[model samples]
Target chain A: MLNSYSSADKVLLAVDCIIFGFDHEGLKILLIKRDFEPEKGKWSLMGGFLRKDEVLDSAAIRILDNYTGLQDIYMEQLYTYSEINRDPVERTISVAYYALINIENHNAELTQNYHAQWFSVAQAPKLIFDHDSMVEHAIRRLRYRTSIKPVGFELLPEKFTMRQLLELYEAILSKELDKRNFISKINSLDILVKLEEKDMMSSRKGSYLYTFDKEKYDAKLLNDFVLNL
Target chain B: MLNSYSSADKVLLAVDCIIFGFDHEGLKILLIKRDFEPEKGKWSLMGGFLRKDEVLDSAAIRILDNYTGLQDIYMEQLYTYSEINRDPVERTISVAYYALINIENHNAELTQNYHAQWFSVAQAPKLIFDHDSMVEHAIRRLRYRTSIKPVGFELLPEKFTMRQLLELYEAILSKELDKRNFISKINSLDILVKLEEKDMMSSRKGSYLYTFDKEKYDAKLLNDFVLNL
Candidate 1:
């Protein structure tokens, strides 16, 4: 069945994952050592080929799992690079996907086995092919996504304080957003659930912890659009 | 040279276009009659194969030129579609692009030869191979783009009346927007040049004609964002 559906212009299909993470330090991206022919021992994003029956999203998830061993990750299709000779080995077109995951929830053993390491947004090393451009576009998109939606929640733990949320936005935008303005904007969106509990570890005045109210957020999403224009 | 880059798994690459246009009536899209086997004669978006040595944008332009004989079109790479068997004939992954062009500028003979027709958003025919979904996504993107930038000008004539401008947004959004509010929102953007001419065809009080100030718009684009939300 597969043979009958073959093509004369057979091209190689690959998936590149832009894995994003946020921690107390700031936002980061995961990179790995290739350890294979061509660009062996150099830094690169986690990637794999698309199986005959798998969708692009699944392939991105598969690649994400290979490095992090995490399921149900937040991943989005970014772009496709089809420049001939992008891969020195063949005529490969890479479909890029960006994933947002909590840094504190990753599997350390799996990442270590894959020689994976996280680098701050300002410090990721040079990558192979057009991977660097993919990362740049993903960061721009992350800034855009972070502006409208409560995407900070995606990169944070289940329960977090307003300061952590502000820091996450600061990392993504690479700018200092006014705290008063930021809190007002988040309140205007009305998507967070304020809890009675407070995170007492960070400050003398314990800041209140909030969990995302998915029900209200999804309901309000119908009338509201996230454009931090 | 090509043989040096052979791979074990080869895939098929296809190109799909989201052609947008505007006339006096409203925003329109171009659909072609599928003239080949396996859903022949069904309505489908304009499309073709990607030949070697061509950039993805170049191939999109080539396809648009073949069917419409129009050049210098406003086209952007939207997304890549890679559902296995979306195209039943082969396991083809199509890179989808969206283009905005003035409908009257295209070569009439070429358009007729391809059996293409301009259908307003309300009357487009049922399309094949997930094209309906593609068109739906393109419309949503068109709305987002028009709100954020001076893109509505692309869908109008070089000189158009204020009424035509308002109708363009209405047609794109598929909603009746309040005229006063719409005018204020547009005036705040400050991207148009109101000419000393009036269009008398629309009303007793002739409406002012405006042309897009391209030079000024481009200059302001770097630091400024134009969103109507």
Candidate 2:
């Protein structure tokens, strides 16, 4: 039966990662300067060809680990770019993935070795191929996913201040949300555990810290809870 | 530069479509009996291999047209499945697309010629390969997409009564909805032009007909509106 597919066309398969991070600066994407390619020296998303034995998920994870030296990141398959001329060198269909990683957790040496840097999504430089369009689609998916799931937590530290949480949401949403409304909405979700500890990073009066109640979050996943702004 | 990619392994690419339809019955999916080797005579999705000169979107559209003889249907690329042993015959990565179509509009003769049948999503038969999983994923996506966009209109007629619209939502969500609440929520969207004409199908008094205001729906697409039950 394998012989039946012999006459079918074969094409190169590649996986691209749009690694998003959030911190005091804003939402940022990890990009590497391509050392070898048809478009060498251009900034592009960290990517590689899919190995024969690996599945798409494993391929995406492998690519991310190769550059970030990070594991167990929250990643999703975004979309596939299959324009006949998307790749100038070959007819490669690239499956894109968006990963949410804690900005502070990645290995600095690995990034430095690969000439990788994080740029604020808005200030991202020109990317090779259709990578700019990939980034745009990823941002849209991130926004839509954040509204339905508590995925924004992936970009934040385990213990974070309400101000940090608000900032993270604002960054992902790319908008300024009213503090009171935001706090009230978060409170209504009842999935946050307000800690007695405070973080004195921003003001003389420290803001209270909070952690996501994973148990509650997991339960909420079974229901239709829309985090409307 | 093209020679640089010669070392990379190539794989066969295929596109499978989960064609969804709705009529007076309920939410349904189009399934076809396999007519070739490997999965001969077993139920499968409408699928085909990608041609060297075509893109993924074009491949999907072509496959759908070949099976259904319908063009310009509402389709979305759902996901890519790439397990090592997913295709027993060869190493093939299948990209799944879900299409919404009006059941009454499809070519009846074409469907019969292709051995195609529409089964209620809940009662769909056991399909070959990972097709059952593909159908499950498509339904989940359809539920999510219908909530954010007015895509349910694609499964309905150009002019339909409020009863038909309510039934469509009921079938998609697979749950009963409060009639007054559903109508009020849809009315608030203000993307439906209610016609003075009536359809006497459900009741003798006749129900008012309504058509989707495309201009208004397009504008609504720019905003974040959740049509919650």
Candidate 3:
């Protein structure tokens, strides 16, 4: 172990977070303007260098918090970007993390200070390095995650309408599902509670709003649940 | 990128390959003996340092070839393990690549020279650093992959039987699938071509062997083929 600990071959490691959020519009990703050189002024995902003592996941969370001022957001390590010259300056291996945070959860001033803005996945500007691919991969992962688990709750507000849930899924999956079948399948799962309060925003006879039952959701996760529609 | 790049912040980046193969018994992973290291004589994943000019994917292939006498195998970048001290020797960030190769198609002796052997994922020895987690994650990825793609062909000989395909999936996924349903699903997907020859080794009534239709597979990949059972 001591011999392998050579100073000759050490390299830099970085953590870049792609924070995803969903609002009435669609799926959006958090981007921060690069305040430092070589890609200074260019838009990039929220990122930071890994510290000497932080785990990759912890470092990712810390970065997400440092800039956005949020906590306990759902984040996943998507992939490692390791092209030789991915960073023009040096060989830095960046582990990309995709996070799901409520858009209203963070401070607006922090976002402005960091020059961070939310952009729809499709509307995002040309990103630095393999970030476009990173975001692409993260979206795929998000779709997969949503299909398997009750992950729609992560992006949406605490309570949401069935239409909102469907829209969120549609945005993540980038496809349309059979409306009746989608509603039926989700209802059959029995993990969503129909809330009495309904916001008559999207329909004349507004659709019944629903919230994910965490107790049931956790139980189903222990077993398994599939949202194929 | 200039401010982001830290040549002084050099760290060790290692490529660990989770070499997967399938045989009569089940799915197996290639392991190697450490001949020169502080942990010499111990079992480890086949790995090496990232070259200055190589991409992570190429580095994975290079490391696998250097130790296994294998090339042109189906290898995918699985995940990066980056707990700061996970590498006992230094701050090493390991990009794990999961390789699916045919067990019967490789040079066992070349791997044997370096004391490399194939072990069932469950029975593999305790690996150094975060390799244990890497193997676990790779297996999870393998399960997810088996459901969506007909990649089991990569682990089998050029020609195989439906029974073998079912067994491979069952073994990799660690679950039982209804033979009838599995066969029907495989047939509907149109990824396998029934061979004129028969394999009499595993059954009293010789099983009709099949080979993967690579052309059809390539075409089918144009649309994401979801295998439902």
Candidate 4:
């Protein structure tokens, strides 16, 4: 019997983060220019090697925090990419994680320090080392997540207009949704708190703002409801 | 600049499979009594250390085939488990995959050779080295997959009665479903074809047998639809 662990080969494990943000422009992802060899100067997802002592989740959190100086963001383990020669330098398996962050909240100095920038997911540059496929998979997962969860709460400002909320869904789904149906469905969820404050930027009449009810949103997280948009 | 990969720690990567099969008894997961130390005789998911040349998907398939002698099974990358000391003997990160197979189709002799046995998912014994949590996660993913895909077709016989289909869903969801509502929702999916044949063993008035429409199933795979049962 091969009873010992000494004979098994060990390989480097990397964690790459697909940090998603949303603004009036649409959904975007945080990308950094690689400063190391093999894919240096190319656009790529922010990533780092997993130390022996760190767990995968912590590694993902550490990488995301390192790049954006943002904490407590909504992040999930997306997928593990393990194509041979995926990393030109060595045999490395990358576990991809995706995070939803409010765009305006991240520190500008931190992003500038790492040379990270946000690009619209639709028009993002071709990425390095299977990162393109990772982004595509993340978008599909995000779309599925949006139907079941109120992702707009994470991406949109605390006080957002109905149009902003609808646009967030449209961007994630990559399609146009009927305005009437969208608002009705959102109303049915009953987790949004309509605010007295109005955003008067779009028109003189102004539009009422809303915020996600945290207690109700947390309840919905526990008991998932289908928002068939 | 730290540009080389030579200094980073490399950890052993393993792939553990939660092989799910369905019989009249309900959903069962294949588990093996470990023959090698450090947890000899304890139940564990069928698993193996991934070789340097192998991808995770291939490693999962190899492990499943090694135990069940089944090939071309429907498998998916579920998640990666990386608690710092998940494995007793080494620093290892396990990428878990789940497979759906027909219980009657696997080779009994091969399973016997490996001391692998099917246990009702509800009554599965305690497993070693974080495997219990792995099974729990797999079952959750299976339940989610059931809502979006025709998983009964993968776990059931080629032609099945409506009772078998309902039972499969019940086992996966662990809840009794309303028969009329279940059938209506399934009918709306338009993926099942009622056949002229009947399973005479169930009753004097044998229930009608049905087979999934492969073309429609393929289409649904490409364009996902919700099955709110």
Q: If scored against the real structure, what TM-score would every candidate get?
A: 0.88, 0.91, 0.85, 0.90
Report the number of the highest-DockQ candidate.
4
lDDT of 1 by residue, A1-229 (tens): 1112233365678888898887767889988877676787788988878777888899888877776576788688998888887888766888999977778877554554556788998988999888899999998887655544557556677898999888877777777778987787778667888999999998888999988988887775321342221
> Model 2 chain B, poorest ten-residue lDDT window?
B220-229
What tens-digit string does per-residue lDDT give for candidate 4 at B1-229? 3335888889999999898877767788888887788999899888888898999999988887776676787689999999988887888899999976767766554554566788988888999999999988988887766655557666778899989888888777777878987788778779999999999999999999999998887865322452110
Docking class of 3: acceptable
Model 2 has fnat of 0.42
DockQ of candidate model 3: 0.32
What is candidate 4's lDDT per residue for A1-229, written digit by digit as tens? Answer: 5334788888999999999887667788888888888888999988889988899889888877776676776579999999999998998999999977767767554555566788888889999999999999998888766644567656777898989888877777777778887787778778889999999997899999999998987765322352110
CA displacement after TM-score superposition, residue A89 of candidate 2 (Å): 1.4
Cα lDDT, all candidates: 0.75, 0.81, 0.74, 0.80
lDDT of 2 by residue, B1-229 (tens): 2124889999999999899888778889888888788889898998888999998888988888777676777678999999999999999999999887778877564555566788988888999999999999998887776665556566677898888888887777787778887888778778899999989877889889999998887875332452110
Q: How many residue pairs in model 3 have overlapping backbones?
A: 10
Ranking by DockQ: 4, 2, 1, 3
- Candidate 3 interface CA RMSD, Å: 5.8
State in Å the error of residue A36, model 4: 1.2
> Which candidate should be chosen as best, given lDDT against the real structure?
2
Deviation from native of the Cα of residue A115 in model 2, angstroms: 1.7
Cα lDDT of model 3 by residue, A1-229, tens digit: 2124453366678888898877667778888888788778889988888877777889888887776666777687788888878887777788998876666656454445455788888888999877888988888777666655546765677788878787777776766777777788778778899999887887888877788888886765321332110
